[model samples]
Target: MRVVTFCDIDESVIDSKHTIENFQSGCSGEAQIAILDINSIFDFEENKHEACADKFTTIAIVEDDSDYDAFKNFGIDAWIKADDFSDINELINLIEKRLFS
Candidate 1:
């Protein structure tokens, strides 16, 4: 599946395993997985739904638990507590799980 990241995630780890792409702006076309930060949500608040209203899943990387409520309001499918992930593989594993679940 195609995985697009809009945050600080490094794509080199999964470059050969999955379709990991880095984007400077919001998702436009078919997006299988989108890794976004809080800023991306608020920055694109006006068109958040229209951009990701399809089968694509948005995974927010947050610094605080309170952010979850705000992200939920925007229809976030899954979330990762910023400080919780120890490495790229762990994060990717969660992303995969969220994609299929």
Candidate 2:
């Protein structure tokens, strides 16, 4: 699956175990999943918003509990803490389950 992320994820955490693909912002393509790290960016462009809307699944990463409510208007499918997961594989597994199950 083609996975895109807006944050500067530590790819090394998952690169050895799984192949992670990332697409740049404003790219025209269908993505299986899109991860938005709100901790890094509070807001994005209209095009990026539209792109995430087209994604099958969209996960938002936030730093605080109040951040979830702040991003509620963005049509986010799910959310996770910015530093909750130690490995990208865990995040990937969570997304897989949420998307498939």
Candidate 3:
């Protein structure tokens, strides 16, 4: 399985690294995970781009309702609420369920 995470710049660097490490050690079966920042794909002038859209199984870490449409428009597989989840383990579980189940 290939897991691609799309997040903001700050979260992209920190959270993505953490998730990658966890997923590498903890994911039950064979899987490869990669992370990309939304900013890396989109500039302020261009809110959306096909390169990012085509290259990822985008998982948006949403805190509120603001970016829901944007992520959905980008064809994200799932939206994991940051505050609602306890930790990366839970997040991994969510991702596993979505992808495998």
Candidate 4:
């Protein structure tokens, strides 16, 4: 499976088994999953996340518990709390469940 990160993120959060790509201006491609950092893209263009949801399984990284609830209804497939961001194992497990289950 291929994953795309919509903002500048710590690359190590993803496992090496899956192909990973970073989004850039004017970039075009397909991805099984798209990860977004809330701090970076929460206030992005309206409907941007909706458009992503149509094309890829979308996951959001949030600052804390409050963030989780705040972004819950925004059309994302899943979320990762801030404390879990650096744990690759957790990231992998969450992504797997969201993508495959």
Candidate 2 lDDT, tens digit per residue, 1-101?
45566676766665454434455534434556666776534443343544443546776877888888877887777677767745556767777776656
Clashes of 3: 0
Comparing 1 and 3 by TM-score, which wins?
Answer: 1
* Residue pairs clashing, model 4: none
**RMSD in Å for model 3:** 8.1
State each model's CA lDDT, in order: 0.65, 0.62, 0.42, 0.64
Better of 2 and 3 by lDDT: 2
Candidate 1 residue 68 C-alpha distance from true site, Å: 1.4
Prediction 4 TM-score vs. true: 0.66
Q: Whose lDDT is higher: candidate 3's or candidate 4's?
A: 4
Please, what are the lDDT tens digits per residue for candidate 4 over residues 31-65?
66777776645543343543343456667887776
Q: Provide TM-scores for the models.
A: 0.65, 0.65, 0.43, 0.66
Q: Report the C-alpha lDDT of model 1 over 1-101, residue by residue, as the tens digit.
A: 56667667655655466666555554554557777888777644554444443667777888898888778888777777777544545666676686556
- Compute the lDDT of residue 16 as modeled in candidate 1: 64
Consecutive 10-residue window with the lowest summed lDDT within model 4: 44-53
Candidate 1 residue runs with Cα over 4 Å from true position: 13-15, 25-28, 43-53, 86-101
Best candidate per lDDT, number? 1
Off by over 4 Å in 2: 15-28, 39-45, 48-55, 97-101
Q: Tell me the tens digit of each residue's lDDT in model 3 across 3-100.
A: 43333333333344333422223332222333333433243114223222333344556667776756555555555565643454455556556655
Put the candidates in lDDT order, highest first. Answer: 1, 4, 2, 3
lDDT of 3: 0.42
